[model samples]
Every structure is written in structure tokens, then in C-alpha cells.
Target: MTDIVMEAKNVYKTYGGSSKKADLKLVEAVKDVSLQIRKGDIKLIFGPSGSGKSTFLRCLAMLDIPDKGEIYLGDECLTKPGVDLNKARARIGFVFQNIYLFRHLTALGNVELALRRVLKLPKEEARERALAALTEVRVTDCANKYPAQMSGGQAQRVGIARAIVRNPDIILLDEPTSALDPELTGEVIDTLRDLAKEGTTMLIVSHEMPFARDVAEEMIFYDEGKIVETGPPSVFFNAPSTDRAKKFMDRIIKRTTRE
Candidate 1:
């Protein structure tokens, strides 16, 4: 009924508080964020550390529960203050900053396990799907190779393949290229672009402004657990429309100039 592939409304999260210290206030990670991503969007969540950008992305992906808010994937309510957690989670695929493949399992095995175990897919079907996903990521040659034998970029691509194998409605990437060299980063970025073009909605948390500029259809800047600005990359980068976003972009500019 809607074009939105994902939605997060009035979401909130916090940390660093214990029952022993009721007076110890929670460090808010996300504050009443309400955002939407249309189907097939490649959206960027970019901001300085502790700005709550990462937390928002995680909550959108269903990896982290929102303390208060509602999330919807398509017509389905995944989270509504409290709701069907399993169904909503099933529609999301999460990728982390570090690739955490099972060392004992070969690349193929790692991808296959998820499909077989979680999805309850038959062996043959799981193998076919896993191989195709790996090929899409251009890591088919390394399918039989163990994670230890692969480079960081290769491992990350495999991580992506694992994510796509589930064929989830949304892919959540947490700094996918933060560890790779420039050349390797290019490979992964290209793979990501292909997925975006294919209409797999994705929300990425990244500090790579150049890549974000190239890949994102929309950009959101967060500050102090709040979304400061959301707009197309052209506008967000060129004209931030807010003091906080302007200051954030200034820092990005400085970082780029120094590097």
C-alpha cells in the first residue's frame, strides 16, 4: 500500500545505565527519530561518532530494539513499542564492520548454514542460492576457500553474500569498507551499487563521504541522538540547511582536506 520499504518512527535507545544507579541517566543513542526509506533506496546515515547515526541504522535493521517507537517494513509492523519481533527481524539482513565468518566453515559453508539452518531450505536449494549470491558478489572463486585465506575485502563481500542469500527486503551495512584498502574498497562498493540497482533497499552507516556521495539516493545527518537533516546527497553536502548539519559537513570537509 506504500512505497516505503522501511520506516522508523519515534524510536529511542540508550546505554550505560544500571539498576543500581536509578539516578544515573541513560545515555540516549537515538531520540524520537522518524524516517522512511522507499523501496530500492540506497540511503546513507553519516555523522560523527556518538551522534547516534549507527544506533539509528541498527534499529532500522532490527538488529537493535528501539526502546520506544514503531518500525515497519512494507505493510508489516516489525516493531510498535512492542509487537511481532520475529517477523520483522526476518525481513532484514545485517552486515557488520568486521566480517565474522565461521573459521571452520568454508565461505560456501558459511553462507549455506544460514539458509539451511534458519530458512530451513533443503541442501540442494541452499547450495544453489548460496553460490548465486556469492557469484553476485564476485566471490564465487573463493567459495571453497576458508575465511582465513581471504583478504578483508573478499571476506566483507562474502559477508554481503551471506546477507543477500536470505533475500531479505532490506540490507543494513555497518561500515562495510572501513577496513579495506582503496582497491578492495572499490570492489565492494561496486558490488553494493549492483545490489542497489537491483532494488534491494539498503541503509548504510559509513564515514566514506565520496562513496556515500556516489551510492546514496538520500542522506541523513544525526547529532546527539537526533536526526539533524535528511535530504539528497547534493543538498546535504552542498547546502546543509541547518547549523548542526553545516557544522557536521564542515568537519567532513576538514577531514577530507587533511587526508
Candidate 2:
């Protein structure tokens, strides 16, 4: 039995070398990035835009294949060949920045689809679980509403419900609130806070400093395709060990304060 829910070892990813342009350089979006998340851990990754945080997250979820290194969900190596990736992915929930709800389906339908299709739950069971998940995210009122009918916050909450309905071992959230309007951000944050209180194991790529400071057990500072610094939230809020992290924190804090 292992306490580690997920682990990444020397994970590497690149892009753009396949372009026809001769001068197009290979961009290393994730360079030898390694991370470990234990049960009930809430770790936050924050850095400059286009720094490959999202790429690393996608690799962890096995949504994007890594060029080098290994990803482990518990003891199972996801990057290995012949693995049932679809089965593995079903155990790992992923919430994207853009709320990718199915426009044709209502909120409940979006959540129930995975249960019925992937998990193969009975129709009545799927509906019950979907409604429960929506209630957990405080979006039960949006159950019958289509994506186009809900507010941004409600839609994102539905996306979260879709992610969590399967009761995956861990949830990987990429900039969960970044796409929402500033005022709407709080509702999503509140849902996340409730999830945190429930001890959900989460690895989130977010810049929501206030929420991070309040809920994250560890904060990782990533930049230039590598993890530059990592520590408890106090280390980043007070004084980061690395100059790069310090400068980044200063810029982010200043911007947050201004907003």
C-alpha cells in the first residue's frame, strides 16, 4: 500500500520542431520535471504564462504523452507501453481552464456521461451520483440547464462535478478559475475550498494566490520549463529561497493587490 497517489519522474515534453520552417526550434515545455503527490495533498503550481505548467499537468494526466520519463498513478506506470490508458485516465479527474461542457447536454447529463460510458454505472445510479456531485459543488440548481444557459461560474462548477463524479483518486485542475470573470471567480474558489475541506487530493495549476495561501499544503514555483522552487505557502508569501521565485512572487502579489 502506498501513500503516494501520483508521481512524475524526470518528465520531459517538447513542441514545434516538427514545423516545416527550418529555423523553428524545439521548445522544451517541460524539462526534467518531477513531482509527487501523496494522499490528501493539495499542491499548487504557479509561474509565468507559457512556462509549461499546463504541459506538465497534461503529462501527469497522460492526456499528453511525455517524450521522456515516467508518470505513475500509485504504483502503475502510465507512461509505459501496453497500459490501458483509458482505464488509467478514468481514475484521474481533470478539470480544464476552459469549461468544456457538452453544449447539447444539461449539467447533469455532462456529469452522468462519464459514469454511464466509462464506469458503466446503471442509468439510475449514474443520475443519482451526478446529482450528488452537482450538489457537492453547489450547482444542483443548474442540473437541467445547458452550458449556454448557465453563468460562467455555474458552468465551471458543472465541469468540476463532471470531473469528480467518478470519485477519481486525484483531481488535476488547470487554471480552474482563470477563464471566469473576476466576480465569478469567487464562486469557483468557494467550491474548491469546500473540496479542500473534504481532503481531496489535488494538484492544481493556479495563480489564485489567496486561495493557494489558504488551502495549499505546498506551493511549487515553476518557470522556463522547470520547477524553480517549492515549499509551504509561507515560504513563498514571506521569502522565497530563490531569486527567481522571489521576483515572480513580487510581481504576482503586486498584480493581485492592484486587482
Find the candidate with the highest lDDT and give its number.
2
Clashing pairs in 1: none
Model 1 C-alpha lDDT per residue in residues 1-259, reported as the tens digit of each score: 6788888889999887768746666789999999888878888888878777778888887778888998888887777556666656667888888888999999999999988887899999999999999999999999999999999889999999998998898889988998898889988899998997788889898877887788788988878999888899899778889988888888888987797
Please report how far candidate 2 places residue 72 from its true position, in Å. Answer: 0.3
Per-residue lDDT over 1-259 for candidate 2, one digit per residue giving the tens place of the 0 to 100 score: 8899999999999998765557677889999999999999999999999999999999999999999999999999999999999999999999999989999999999999999999999999999999999999999999999999999999999999998999999999999999888989999999999999999999999999999999999999999999999999999999999999999999999999999
Q: Each model's C-alpha lDDT?
A: 0.86, 0.96
Q: How accurate is candidate 2 locally (lDDT)?
A: 0.96
CA shift at 242, candidate 1, in angstroms?
A: 1.6
The deviation in Å at residue 148 for candidate 2 is 0.5
**CA lDDT of 232 in candidate 1?**
90
